[model samples]
Target: MQLSFETDVEAFRAEFAAFLDEHLPRGAESLERPRSTAHIPEWARRWQRLLFDEGWLLPGNPPEFGGRDASLLQQYVHLEELARRRIYHSFNPQGLGIIAASLLSFGTEEQKHRWAVPVLRAEKTAALGMSEPGAGSDLASLRTRAVLEGDRFRVNGQKVWTSGAHDADFILTFVRTDPDAPKHKGISVLIIPTDTPGVTRRPFGSLIGPADLDFNEVFFENAEVPAENLVGELNQGWTVANGSLGHERTLLWLGFAERLEDLTQDFRPDGVLGRDRYATLVMDLQALRLMGSAALARAARGEQDVAALSVLKLFGSEAVQSATEAALETAGPDALAHPARTAPFNPMTLEDFYAGWFERYARSFSGTIAGGASEIQRTIIAERVLGLPRG
Candidate 1:
């Protein structure tokens, strides 16, 4: 099936494209991806601020929240353009995308103005504090403890895979307030300032490479946070946590589809194996696009198809992984070389396409596991969509 936007949406897309062209020049100078939140250059900061000021940061949000309250189709077109051009409006995804969204959904008016506003304006950065050593997929089993005092909560625990924590202004942390309660209960979210006493952030690398300082291990020992910093009601953190992930998972399929489409444009048939794989990858990309379009249409009509969303999320991420892996294999022994010594990662140019395939392949694994793992999606689809019994 063909998916095309209406004339008004097409006009909106053109207007946004012009704005991007005027601001983002494709000349001698280009901005490389920042190493970490702390390493963002002044130019990048200015760029993000400009996007916010111009109401292009988040088209779906209201004007005060760095958006113009754009319609659903407009937002879809906006995302499509950004992804197609590989432009990131915000360098801090966990902050602007997940944390700020959560605050908007569940934060008090004071919290929204105090924390979320600055983040939307690019004046502050945040890191999500979830997923400890023992609790990655099964997040409810987290062991971090926070004991409330008269006016503050003294926290003591470790949080692993806290992305961009070292340089972030604060961490939107999830901690257990009552150990006696069930695993899912007695949990709460706290807006913990990174500079608070007894707070330590150790930046680390991922499978992407040692130079990629995107993840951190944060340790909070006797860290005292104000009681007012609590997000949502006490022992209702599961709700906030679900809302955070829901925000993240929403519309992610568009990005997945965009990246795969970009890669497909540069893929070349090596031999019979390459031809077969390329054909399969193309078909999968088309299927993902159709599914994403259908999901978007359903959303515009105010419908919530959780099972369809589960399938789209699971299929889109895995399709990207499969395509990138195939491209790397098609490049043969060349992909075996050390990634650092190879060409920089730029899918826009064919010269660096195969050279960057290994890096892309390495990073694809994270997408499958990020918002929620593939296993989690499969279980949801089975139990809810297929009406299968949980084993």
Candidate 2:
């Protein structure tokens, strides 16, 4: 697929760029720490509200839901430009991007009317409750249970590694509504209010060391939510979950592109060692970008399967790992030792910074493990994508 932007897309990009130029955070340079996850602050919420007022927050949603009824290309343009400018950090992505999108796909009319507008407006934040303490990538093994009783479902289980649970007003949770049935078949999705009587959220510090990007362990003790809270049909949550994964991977290419640009800025073409290393890194980065962009385009066109997303995830994660390694190598021993003067692009200090890079290294490996393991991705590619015989 051609990667070039069309005339209308170019206009969309220009408009988004102008918005970012006018509204990006002031005094943001003084902030010493880097946020791991995209957690929008109050100022950022005001910025998002501005976008909502202008019908730009949920660019992909229908116009009735406070969106522009934007085409896929238009949405891609918005995301690409935002990521290019590092403006994604200023939006409540979980609400406006992921959950809201999923809701639009599977939610009932009442569900959409109740949640979509607030979500797009940034009035309510949502957290994903898919991963549990015992179940991460192997979501089929999830033990979170929900039992039907009268007009409500009683939910009782714990979800770990839940980002923004403490700050979120609601959770889009996956639970087993039928323990006796097959693992994947018994699952169901629910939108539970975080302020429910039996709910408790505890913040768990990330290995990444970002204070606001706290992961959480959420406890649901016989939490009762209306039966109408269910998203899509019962025992079909896996389908919805898979759909969510596809949507996420579709947009991740923009992030990978942004990282690639950041990786390139550190290169010094005239320097002897710099020229050689930079050349190799840039080539690999371009290849990864090509693969990721292809996967995204295929997904957007609905030509790719859910398993194909795992391939993009694998390639994207590895590219990020390789790029970080190259950046560190370029810095040499001084990279180990923080430079006396910090570059605007490379703002991290070397001392008190071991934890961040270490976390990146660990999480690069974990990213493979998070969405799905590299092994799993390879299996899917081999058997599903490549038509290899199962062993």
TM-score, every prediction: 0.93, 0.85
Full-model lDDT for every candidate: 0.84, 0.72
Clash count in backbone of candidate 1? 0
Clashing pairs in 2: none
lDDT digits (tens) for residues 120-197 of candidate 2:
766677888999989887888899999989899999999998877887889999999989988878999999999999
Candidate 2 lDDT score at position 122: 65
User: Which parts of model 1 have CA positions greater than 4 angstroms off?
Assistant: 25-33, 37-39, 270-273, 337-355
Backbone clash count, each prediction separately: 0, 0
Off by over 4 Å in 2: 1-3, 28-39, 210-213, 269-276, 296-302, 305-308, 329-366
Cα TM-score of candidate 2: 0.85
Best by TM-score: 1
How does candidate 1 score on lDDT? Answer: 0.84
